[model samples]
Target chain A: MKRKIEFATIVEAVKKCCIEGTKVLPQDVYLKLEEAEKNETNSLAKDFLRQCILNADIARNEAMPICQDTGFAVYFIEIGQDVEIIGGTLTEAINEGTRQGYKEGYLRKSIVTDPLFERKNTRDNTPAVIHYDLIAGDKLKITFAPKGGGSENMSGVKMLKPSDGRAGVVDFVVNTVVNASGNPCPPTIVGVGIGGTFEKCAFLAKKALLRKVGEKNPNPLYAELEEEILNKINQSQVGPQGLGGDTTALAVHIEYYPCHIASMPLAVNLNCHAARHYEVEL
Target chain B: METKIIKLTTPLTADKVQSLKAGDRVAISGVIYTGRDAAHKRLVTALDENRELPCNLQDAIIYFVGPCPAKPNTPIGSAGPTTSGRMDAYSPRLIRDCQLRGMIGKGNRSQAVVDAMTQYGCVYFAATGGAGALIAKSIKKAEIIAYEDLGAEAIYRLEVEDFPAVVAIDSSGKSLYK
Candidate 1:
């Protein structure tokens, strides 16, 4: 017999996800902030890093958003085949929960109705970007990430020759961040996607950002590669706000998938220290 | 750190500017109006129309922000600096036409804005971008000054005390980023 999960439970879970996601700022990000503070060489940059930590603390205490950008809400939902949701549709519940969380949490309403003309505010932050996938269990898992535009603006993807290999990937990512400079709010988390098709590579790169900082790839070779990329990125000396210093990037995470024999695609997504994401399983 | 409150109507002198550096903490008292992209566009359009501005811009520091709606019993919600670059195009016009002296926001400014700062002896200050609630504590009061139709984007006359900020760009053409 299939187990039925109440729609209220799903809505409550999503609301909790949004609240926890905005307030906590993630353990990986916290570790990265501490690391960036230690590694920052420029005095101004060091102070800025310290302020970022303090900002996190204040946000936690106040139960408010850590950044003014509150960000565009995006969710990745893994739904089980055996579980049935009652009362309302999943999309309706999620959007309703988003509106409630943004209104109740005092987060900013960043969405506008029309991007081109009549740029009227939607009033409430709504219509989240939801990606759903089906899995084989009775459990429902969801991850909500509030992606700010600064780092989102700096993300890039490319389809290179298989012969170009790892060197090509490194050069592309480093060049992207170096060019970005202080725009994305430095000491960023670099997410690299390799091997998948063009769109898949981009998707994987964003998903890779959700991984914990300092956590190594399961594959030893990939783990070593991540370390190398992290070191090389710091050497750029872009520092915080592009003032030129020792620490430019906090961590480099790479996630890969098998690609076609002839195709080699790479994508890179840069996330600022405000990288806010949280997950819940119901 | 010692705190002092300066009213907005008082003209900012060179001595006042010199007293503050890239990292000095300050609390602005009295009336200071807020304006961002949409309101700025309308203000500039009014100037182009050869009409007077909604509020006097002489010696004023325009804050580039669109704060969240005020919750009940609260003056304002999570008010913080938005990215300053988005307002770069509209800022030079405001500075030149309206005699605006200072700006408060985050990130870097264009060379043209820097040039205007030097020519007009203006300054650009950086408020803590993400520390909205902590920053809000310094603001004792807030009222809608103009552009009420813009919703949260409306112009607000805020009265603040000990609002912490760093001078990102000074009158000497020196940038904090450099």
Candidate 2:
């Protein structure tokens, strides 16, 4: 049976998610900050972590964006095979929801009409970077993340020779994140994507960011890789804002897929301390 | 926090600029101007054409930020520092031509800019990145004075009180990053 879903329902939910996503830091990420503060020994670096905690509190209690760079509104939609749309197309509804939410929620519009030439503000933070997946079920899942430009600018995708192996992947990921230093806003969540093709690996890296901070990969081998990366990053002493401390990164999450026989593709996407992502299933 | 926090105000004086050291926590009060990549681009363009800046740059502090629009009854929203590296291409010229005294933003600066700061007696301060909402509380008033069409990237004049920051680079070319 096809489950009928109203276009308005999705619009309203997207609007709410846009506001809720940027206004409130997820509990898992918030708790991780608290833990980082407790574990960090450098007084100055610990203070930066404290400010992060306090900033989230102010943003939530005052109904303000956690950061001024409300960022590019990104949406990940999963549509079940057994679902039917009642009013309009899914893309149109999502964009409308984004427009209304950014306007009503007082979120900043960061999107440009053109990337190279005019670079005029779109006025509404619309035409979101939407990704869709078709799945089997009668439900729809909407996931939203407000990705800051500073962090997003630091993303990397590299094609490596298969023989480069585990050691090579680890080195590239660490180098990219560490070289980024304070620019990505440290105590960041490192998202690693291994395998897949060029663009596919980058997408995988971004998708990996939606995972809860400190959540382990389902595969135990990959989980061990995550732990190893996390320890190495923290030891870099890049600290909060790359100013120096023991809390450079709170967690590292790795997502992988089988790829071409000869090529090993790797992508790293770093999410700042204000890692905000929210999802709803209907 | 056992560290002694310094309290400073602007338009800053030469003596005051020289007193700061890397890693010193500062609470800045008084007037400052905001700009980001676009505004910096324009300002440098104006200088190239031998035109006056929208505001006098002498002894002025330029904060690299693109703030969220203010809410009802609020001066500004979620105003935080952006990475300063993008401004590297234009900063040395501003320092040499206008005696630009200080800058507030996140991330390390380029060598040429640091050399200019050392040559011209300026300082670089860093705000906690991503702490926008907390930082907005310090901005008492904000008004767009130039390039309104640029929206967030437009230059804004702000009245601030006890704005929190740390010295990332000092007048002598000393830095926190190294």
Candidate 3:
């Protein structure tokens, strides 16, 4: 027998996740900021890191958003083969939830109806970006990560010859971030996606940001790569808010996929220190 | 070395901000205006077409921000600075034309913007990036005065008190970024 999941349940879950995610900075990110502050040598950068912590606390306590740029809603969802969604379409349910969450939570409605020409506000944040996956169990899981424009604008994708190898990847990632400086709101959490096609590489880079701040990649080689890239980035003196210090980045996460032998593709996505994500499983 | 937190009040004049230098922290008070990407485009367009702007921008500080809606009983919500680079194309013109005294936002600016600041006796300040909720406490009032249709990108008159920022570029063309 297939498991029946109510559409309202998913809507409510997404609604709560959107509000909570925007309001509260995740524990892992908060702790990492604390650690960064302790390790920072520059007094100004250290004070800025402390302010980030205080800012998060104020948001959490007051039941308000941590930043004005509440971000574009992006969802990663998984559905079991034996599960059925009833009463409405999954996409509609999520969009409805987003509309309610952003309105009720006092989050900014950032989406403009059209990107280029007549950039009109949607008023209600709707038509969220969603990715779906099929899994074996009788369960449904949804993860919401709000992506702010500042950090997203600084993200990039690059195609490299296989001959360029690890050296090329490191150089590209470091330069892209260091060059951005304070524009993306350092110290940032960097997400690097390697291999795959152009679109898949972009997706992987964003998905990599969902992982815990300190969690290393399961693969030994990628784990080592994460540390190396992170060290090189921190040495650039970007620091907190790019004013200069020892804590330019909290973590560097790399997710990889097998691709055609002919090309190497790389994507780099950056999340501001406010790094907010929340999820639910049912 | 010790750093000083310079105090400032709005409706700023060139003489008032002349002493500001790169690396100095500032606590700004009184009135300032808020305008971001779209609002800037409109403001600059008005200047280009030789039309009058809705608000008086002379000797003003324009903060680059779009705040979250206020919760009941509060004057404003998480009001933080956005990336300043996006406003580059419009800033030099505003600086020279309006006699803009100071600008508050995050990120390094262009060479043209720096050059304008040097010539026009203006300063650029960078707020604590991503510190939105905390910054809101400094904003005492906010009322949309122009381009209300732009929603968050609307131009608003804000009354701020001790609004904190750091001097990113000074009148002498000194910059904190490499």
Candidate 4:
């Protein structure tokens, strides 16, 4: 017989996850912000960074959102094949939890029904972007990330020739950040996806952003490349708010997957200073 | 990093607006109202209908924000500035009709809006967009004066003290970025 997980328990967990995720800025992001504050050279940018840090502290203390753009709630779930959800559907529980959390937590309902025309606020902030995978174990793992639109707008993916190699990846990432100066709120966290298909590369780029700050890649070559890219990005002098200074980026995280011989796919996902995310296992 | 509070009425003169510039840290005191994309649409609609506005716009600085909902015992929730470009289409009308003199937000604005600010003696200020908690500290009180049904997007009459901001566009048509 399959192990049963109560729907109400899952709903409660989802609500808690969403609320806590918005209120608390992730540890990695906090470390990055602290480093950015220490390294910022421009007076105005320094003040801005200081305010960002204060904002995080206050948000956590008061249980308020760190930013007005509470963002679109997204979750990646890994479910066990041996476990079964009882009482309700998985999607329904998650949506219900999202609605409750947005209302109770006082977060902004940022979702609109239509993209182009007749754009209407959904009010409850329901219908989260959820990704699920079947896993071997009986445990259910969920990661929540509140992705702001500014950085999301700046994300890009490219397919380069195998001959392009590391140099091509560096150029593309730097160019993307330079072009996006001040738009995504600099002193950004860069997530690079390498060695995947077009869609897979984009997915990996976002996944890489979930990694802890200052953490090195497991692969020795990739780890070295991450440091190289970090040095080049900090040299951009875009600084905080593009005012020109040292420390344009806090860290560069690279996630790679095995790909076909003919193609070299890459992607870059930028996360703003207020990177809010959390994970829970049930 | 000292803070200073300045309070001024709307339909402000060129001299007052020109005195401020980008990167000059300021704390805006006194009465300011909030509005964003949805409220902008309604304000424009009211103007088109020849109906009365929810609040007096003359000599008022309209903040482009749709703050998070207020929790119990709290004056306001995470109240931060929204992107200003989203309100470009409706701002010119507000400036002309309501004698509005100042706007506050972040990021770029359109040429027409810039021209309107110059012609109308209005100025644009930028508050740090993501610094909601810190910004909320400067807001002493917040009351919903209009459009209560719009939820967070409603017009709020805020009594603030030393609300920090930087002058993005000056009265004489000088842009900080340029």
Q: Considering summed lDDT, which 10 consecutive residues are worst modelled in model 1 chain B?
A: B1-10
The DockQ scores of all candidates, in the order shown, are 0.45, 0.86, 0.87, 0.51
Q: Reference contacts recovered by each candidate, as fractions?
A: 0.40, 0.81, 0.83, 0.52
Worst 10 residues of 2 chain A by lDDT: A229-238
Give me the runs in candidate 1 sitting further than 4 Å from their true place. B1-31
Please identify which of the two predictions, 1 or 2, would achieve the higher TM-score against the true structure. 2
Q: Model 4, which residues run further than 4 Å from truth?
A: A159-165, A260-263, B1-13, B45-52, B96-99, B146-149, B176-178
Ranking by DockQ: 3, 2, 4, 1
Q: Write the per-residue lDDT of candidate 2 for residues B1-178, one digit (tens) a residue.
A: 3778899999977789999999999999999999888899999999989888899889999999999988899999899999899999988988999999999999889999999999999999999999999999999999999999998899999999999999999999888884
Which pairs clash inside model 4? Answer: B10-B59, B10-B60, B11-B59
Task: Give the range of the ten consecutive residues with the poorest summed lDDT in model 3 chain A.
Answer: A118-127
Provide the lowest-lDDT 10-residue window in model 1 chain A: A238-247
User: Candidate 3, which CAPRI tier?
Assistant: high
User: Which pairs of residues clash in candidate 3, taking residues 3 or more apart in a chain or in different chains?
Assistant: none
lDDT of 3 by residue, A1-282 (tens): 899999999999999989999999999999999999999999889889988999999999998799899999999999999998999989999999999999999999899999999989999877799999999989999999999999999999999899999999999999989998998999999999999999999999999999999799999999999999999999999888888899888999999999888989999999999999999998
TM-score of each: 0.89, 0.99, 0.98, 0.90
- How many clashes in each structure? 1, 0, 0, 3
What does candidate 4's lDDT look like per residue over B1-178, in tens digits?
A: 5655465543355577767665556668888999988899999999999999999988788998888877888888888787687799999999888878889886667888989888887888878767787788888789999987776788999888778887777767777552
Candidate 1 lands at a TM-score of: 0.89
Q: How close is candidate 2 to the true structure, as a TM-score?
A: 0.99
Best by DockQ: 3
